[model samples]
Each structure stands twice: as C-alpha cells, then as structure tokens.
Target: MVKDVFTNVVANLVTALIFGVSAYIILYIRMSGITQTIRRVIHPKQRVFALHDLKINGINRLEVSKFLSPLSEHERDILVKFHAARNGSNPHNGSSIRLDGISPVSNDKKEYTAHISKVGFFDFIATNLTAYPANAPIRSFRSQMATLMRSFRTFGLIQQVVNEVHKYGEPKKVEDVLENRSLANIISVSVLIVDATGRIGIVERTNKVAVSSGNFGATCAGTVGDVDFDADNPFESCGLREIKEELNLDLERLHFDGIVVPKQKMQPIFLYHASIDQTWEELFPIMEQARDISFETQAFYAVPVEDIIKFASHTRMTDTAAYQVWQYAVKNGQDNNWYKTLLLPFDVKRYLIPWNSQKDGTK
Candidate 1:
C-alpha cells in the first residue's frame, strides 16, 4: 500500500508540472498577440511624427515602412482636394489662397502693375493703386504663389477648407469645445512616450491618478519644455528635454527609433526608443544612481509589447489624447510581429524592455 501511494504521488506531480508549463505558454502567447495589436495601431502615428522631426533620434527601417503606407480614406480625400486646390484645378471652390500671402495669380499680363501689402490669414487686400506697368515678367507673382502653396499645406489649409463647410465646422466658441485653448493649460506639458520597439509608450492603472493625468497613462513620459535649445527643432528639443527630466536619460547613446504623432491632436508629440542589452549587474547600477530615481509619484512603469492591448482596454482611459496613444501602441506592436514572422521565421526574440525591472532581473 505504501509503494502504490508513492507511485501515484510522483505521477501526479509530473502531470501538474506539464499542465503549469502549458498554461504559461498559452498565456504568454495570448499576451504577445495582444501586444501586436497595440503596436499595429501605434506604429503609423510614430512614423509620421518621426518624419516631421528633422533631427529625430532612433528611427529604424521597419518604422519607415509603416509610415509610407497608403493614406486612409479620409486622408486621401483631403490630400486630393488640397493638391488640386493648390494647383488651381478647383481653387475657386474654397476660400481665397490670398489669405496665406501666396496669391496664385501670376503677372503674365505685361501691362499689370504690382503692389505689396501685408495681410493676416483670411484677410485679403487688393491694391487699387498700380505702381508701374512692366514689359519684363515680374518674378514676384510666381514666387508668391509657390510660397502660398507651401504655407497652405504647412499651416493645415485642408482642415480649414473642410471645416468651413462641414456641419462639424459650425463656428465654434472656444467655450463650447473641449479643443479650446483653455484645455491647453491643463496639459501644458506634452510628452512623447515611446518603447524599445519604436512603439508609443503606454501604461495601465486602476487608480484615479491616471484618469486625472494630463494626456495619457504612460510609463515613460516627458513634458515639452522650452528650457533648452540643444536642437533647432521643437520636437527634437522637447524629446531631449523630456528624457533628461523624466528619466534622467542621456539621449546621445539611445538609438533613434522613430517619431509618432497622433493625427487627431493639434500639438503633436514625438516618440523615440532605444534598445538595452546589458545584464542587470551592468544596468541597475546606472539607473539606480540617476538623478531622479523615484517612480512612486509618477506611476512610471515600462510596459512590454506583449501586454499592450490589455493596458489599452481599461475603461478609465477615456481622455481622447490618452486613447490615441494607447491605440497607437497596440497597432504598431502587432504590425512588427507580423512582418518579423515572415522575414525571419525562427528568431522570436523580444527587443523591448520596460523601464522598471527588479534589481535581480525580474519585472
């Protein structure tokens, strides 16, 4: 009887071990799937922000590819109208381009006189007083037209055009909209949180602090500040300032991953990332010794790509800006895994490391 009992106990233990491992593998893969979904959403925005950031750090080839995909239905339509209007195909359908100081009119008529006047956007002044009639082709007219087109696109002419006529564009008082400048004060600082895979940084919290937080629930966050001018571009300067203040991280060594800005927001944020390969012995010492080592108040924690979707699905993440960041992370994470499977079959390595990990190398 004793021998039979021992044999049964051993068999049960072996079965338990197999079941535990199987459960872990299933859970891990499910988490990974969730992560991929997050990345796919985040990737496009990051790519765009990176392109706009002339001095952006840490951009890689995969991110570049995602950004170059075909424009969405709405974006394609807007682009078509914008391009056509600027080219004079249907310029008369919208507001005068003259407001942007880029009059599409050329001095092809030799007898026409030229006059200069400074006008604000949407304000046009036609000079009734002609200075001179010239036989020589006036270069200023063509130059002005080119300048205007550039300004129109740069200053978001497409939005203005669409807004002027759309029901959604009904003349809005600043008080009536959440997009009013007043909301700016609440989120005075903008942070472009990012991850190691060039994905937008995200975080999940059941606490109310996240709900009341300025823009998003993200672990690695940096506020946009004007304190320094190390880089000529705003995005680059902001990125550097944020890393220094928030993480006490030196941007010089971090690899440039990509920049991401969600299309829905007015003031864009740029995302950047770098890979860390050192063991805990070489890693924790440096991080621990950093100037601002505390994470208690900030609620800062790096999220792996595998857990992105779960983080994003929280009900408390209702802030539009925060939601955009979450969505961006999930989409881009998946897109990366999808392509990796096709390009390199056997190498299923995770390149992303969360900012917070135990001293002994556990999360």
Candidate 2:
C-alpha cells in the first residue's frame, strides 16, 4: 500500500508539470501574435512619391483652377445618414477644397497647376472614414462601414449603398488614383517648423482630432478651407493660416519642399519647411499661449536635426509626418547610409516627373 501511494503522488506531480508547460507555451504564442498585429496596425506599409523635381521656390509657382463635380445621389445620402449616426446630430456641411488633378505647365516640371473643386466637409468625412487600406487596424473600409451600419440599425440598406459608392473598380497605377474624380481627395498642408537653432519642432496630436489622434504629426496641419483659398498662392496661404491658428505665430519664411501622397490614405499633402526667427527655448513660452493648443496638441518636442531619423525609429508618427522628416533630412545632405542602419516602416518611391509624361498626365 505504501509503494502504491508514492507512485500515485509522483504521477500527479508529472501531470501537473506538463499541463503548466503546455499552458505557458500556448499563452506565449497568442501574445506574440497579438504583438505583431499591433505593430502592423501602428506602422502600415506606406509609399510616398515626390511630385516635383526641384524645390518650388515661390508661392506663385503653383497654380490652381476650380473644377467642381456634384456628389452622386448615393454619396449625398451616405454623407447625411453616416454623419447623423456617428455624431448623434446634424453634420456640419462646411466648404472644403478637393484635389482633382495636377499637371505641369509648358513641360516645366518645377511649375505645376493643381485643379481643385469645392466639396462639403460632411461629404469628405463620409468618404474618408472608409478610405483606409485593407491591412489597417480597422480592417478594410468595407468591413468598417458594415460594422457601423449594423450598429446604427441600418445594416441591410446602408451596406448596399456604401458598397456601390466605395468600390475599388480596378487595379490602377498610383497616378491614376490621384486624378480619379470619384474619390474625395481633399488637399491639406503640413508645415514642418524649424526654429533658429536648427532644431525641428514636432507636436503630439491630442485625442480630440478625428484622424490620426494621439499620433505625432507636423507642427500644424489643416485642410484647405474657403478662407485659405488665395487666387495667387492658395497652398502657401493655407500653410500660414494653420500655423497661426495652431501656434499663434506668424511665419513669413515658409518654403514649399514638395508634395507627398501617402499610399495608406492616398491623400496628397503639400509640405512646407517653415523657419522661425526665435529659438525653441524662446518659442516655448509663446507656444504655451496658443489658442488651439489645448484642443489640438498634447505636447511639443524640440529635436535636433541629426537625431530625427533615430527619434522617428523609436517613436510612432503619422505616415505624412515621417515622410516629411525623411525628405527634409535627405534635402539637407544627411547621409543615406544612416537611413539603412535602422529598419523603417514605410517604403518611399521617389518619382521624378519626366518631361514627356508631364502633358500626358503620367508619372
């Protein structure tokens, strides 16, 4: 009897050890998968293309023309219903600038003309909310719309409406997509502010914003509203207006770096390198008094130019913001070897506008 009891105790001990080990292995595998998924969502694959060969020196170098296209019946209905369901109230149907097409003038790659149209803000919101890539955290835009429609108790009808409106018709080139009139392509400006001491100013966006909330972005950015439309220099005026609203400082030395369109959202953002006369130390107190600080920015960091790539490697940044930093670094003669030292999240394809392709609307 004594021998039998001892044997039973040993068997139980072995069984418990095996069970614990198996459970631990299973948990580890699950945790690892979750970590990878989170990483992909945070840093989706992005491709940024440079629209101009030379740095656009003057504000007037870019030209604009108005080309309006009224929204379809289905789109209009989606805009109204989605806005009401999402906000629990009527939508703000403000005016916004939509990018239609871009063409170089007289075979000059440096000079270009942008065709824009006025679109309602609610229309942009309705379309843009479902414009994310397939691999995004929220899955494809179709899935997201389906979930929202179901939650709003209009699943069957709204799903059919959205399906028809948001169809990715064919596999087209990037240039074709940019000029596609069907998409709600809004034009926005991203200003990268460099203080007198050569340190780059980066701001952390708060959770109040609709898109890219809690992510690091440019110093100040906003859509091209009606107030920002200048007959002579609309893009420049938009950039300056955003800076004034977000930082409360008037910047006169803004240079158009280039235009970048991130593949994730497929939105073209005009990037400007703005220089401030004050050092970051002196600018801090003034920034503290910004009218929109509480609502837009959570905090600010002054990073030296050399540490930009390193800083970006460890921190999470919006796709446009990260590309802006990389473009600035490259333009400033930063060594390309440094970029290879660390693995970056996005792939940037620099396409120079060929002379022949300019008139044909080809890249």
Candidate 3:
C-alpha cells in the first residue's frame, strides 16, 4: 500500500509538469502573435506613386461626399477623458477629409479613381491614436495618450483597441483598413519646396504641433480641411494654404507631384513641389517672419539636392518627408552618381514601387 501511494504521487507530479509546460507554450505563441500585430500597425512600410502614373481627371478626379462614422460610446468616453486630462477642455474639432476607397480603373493597375469623405477631427483623432506604439518616444499628445492608455500590457491592449476600432462600425481588420485603402481616417498634404539653386527646404517641427513633434518634416504640411472643398483645386489649395501659413512665402509655380500612402497610419499624403525664385539665403528672412512660426516650426534647414540622401540618413524625418525626398531624388538624380548611393546605405527601392514602365503613359 505504501509503494502504491508513492507511485500515485509521482504520476500526479509528472502530469502537472506537462500541463504547465503546455500552457506556457500556448500563451507564448498567443503573445507573440499579438506583438507582431501591434508592431505592424505601429510601424508600417510606405508606398510611393508618381503623379502621371495615376489618371486623375479634372473635377471628377476626386469625388467628395458626406460620410457619417460616429465614434462608439467607449471611444467617445476615452476621447472625453483624454481631453479633460490633457487640455481641460475640448480642442478644436474641425472637419477633415477621409479616404473612402480607391477604385482601380484598368487592369494595367496604373490608373485609379480616388474617393474621399468628410470626417470630424475628433473621429480622426480617435481612430488614428493607436497608430503609434505605447513606448514611442515622440512627445506628441497622441503618442502620450496612447502610452497612458496602454502602459499595462501594451501589446495586448493595442491589439484589443485596434480590433475594437476596426469592428466598431465596419467588420474589417486594422491592416485591411490601412493597407488596402478600405478606409483612411485622415488625408493630409505635404509640400517640398525647392529653391532656384536646387536646395530643398526642411523644417523642424515644434512640440506645440499635434503630430511628429520635434521631428524633421516637409517644408509645409496640413490636413485637407473642410474649407478646401470650395476651392477650385482643393488639393493644391490646401498645399498652398499650408505654405502661406507655415512659410509665409508664395510661389507662382506649385506642382502637384504624386501621392504617398504610409502604412503607419495609412494616411494619404498629397505631395506637392513648389519652386521659389529666391535662393535659401534670400528666403530665410521671409520665413522667419511667418505668422505661425513660433507655433509650427522650430527651425529650417536648406539642404542641397545632392546631399539630401545623406541628410536623411542622419535626421529623424517624418515618413512623408522621407518619401518626398526620395521621390525628388528619383525624378532629378537618376543619372547622377548620388542616385546610386540611395541604393546602397538606405535602400529606398524596397519601399518605393517601380515607376510605371510606360513613363510617357503612352500605349
């Protein structure tokens, strides 16, 4: 009887050990998946496309419509709490544009019709707050809020919040919404200013800004607000407005370049290139007197076209700014030796889609 009891105890110990090991393995796998999902949402690869490759017709090119995507009760409460904690009152909730879909017009995949809808600024903030990881060092309000909400079990909570947002109104995955262009909560414009001397203008963002604070970004950028809808060229109008507001400089030649959709937030950035007759030295004084300089820009750097790649290597640039530089280099430096360096150290080719084979867009 003694021997039988001892054997039974040994068998129970072995069973418990096996069960514990199995449960640990299961939990680790689940946690690993959650981590990957969160990382993908936080740090997504960017896609860059040229203008001519896309067939954007006159007024019909971008069709805007009214869209009503209200936040859930939980999301509304979270927003309220965040505002109360951060600003002690609700901030300006202006109307912004949201990308609804991009319909492919042809089998060649070169042409697409872009569709957008109007969404409130609050909705934009709520949906896109999870784009940053909890530990992101950026001092922006959104990043801080994300950190506050997901400090505990960061990855799991991020995944849960993303899932909830995705399922709130539409049954879709966060990746699908961002990557597939199913729904982009916000659409903004970024402008690259090139001087007559072939120098690119770069700006350092101030902490007062809502996004990408303390980071280098495009010369000027702003959301495509509701006011742009009435303009003759809404996209260009938005770009020019940002230029006037941020740089206090006007250009007669503002060219629409293309669009870049970054995976991080899946925000569509309408890219513009403006040429100024003045050299960097001549333009500095005017920029200093910009109306919103104290609130928007910390400093401005005039980087030579040839050295942009090297500058990008050293500076912490916003994703849209990096792509804008890359696109500019590809457009002007293809035959130059500096273009080859873009392939070696940075390898931006991995991110930029191949230029349309028919450069002239001729069949």
- What are the lDDT figures for the candidates, one per model? 0.33, 0.61, 0.60
Over the stretch 1-363, how does candidate 1's per-residue lDDT look in tens digits? 999999999999999999978865554443223433343344233422222213322211111111111223354445444333333332122111110011123344212111111111111100100000001111244543563455455345334433322322322321122122111211112343453444443333222221122222443444333232223343345555555644555655433332333222222233444444434224434555555444312333344455443444332332333434444554565433323333333321232334455435664
Question: How close is every model to the real structure, measured as TM-score?
Answer: 0.34, 0.68, 0.66
Per-residue lDDT of 320 in model 1: 32
Q: Quick one: ranking by lDDT, best first?
A: 2, 3, 1
On residues 1-363, what C-alpha lDDT tens digit does candidate 2 reach at each position?
999999999999999999978865554443223332333233322445556464433332224433222356565566556444443344456777777666666455666666666666655555544443211123344544554454456444345434644464532444555655445667789998888888788887775665556667777888888776554567788888888888888877578877776655566688888777787767655665678877788667777677665555445567778778867877787753433535654321111112232346662
For candidate 2, the per-residue lDDT at 247 reads 84
Q: State the TM-score for model 2.
A: 0.68
Report the lDDT tens digits of candidate 3 across residue range 1-363.
999999999999999999978865554443223333233222212333323455433333245443343346465446534533433234467888775656667788666656666766666554565543211142354644453454343444345556655553542332245343323367788998888888888887775665556667788999988888666666788888888888788765477776665544546678888888787677666766678876887667777777776555445666667767766776886333433443465432222211122234541
lDDT of 1 at 20: 78
- In candidate 1, what residue range of length 10 has the lowest lDDT sum? 125-134
**Backbone clash numbers for all candidates listed:** 29, 0, 0
How would you order the candidates by TM-score, starting with the best?
Answer: 2, 3, 1
Scored by lDDT, model 1 comes in at: 0.33
Off by over 4 Å in 1: 1-216, 253-268, 278-285, 293-300, 315-363
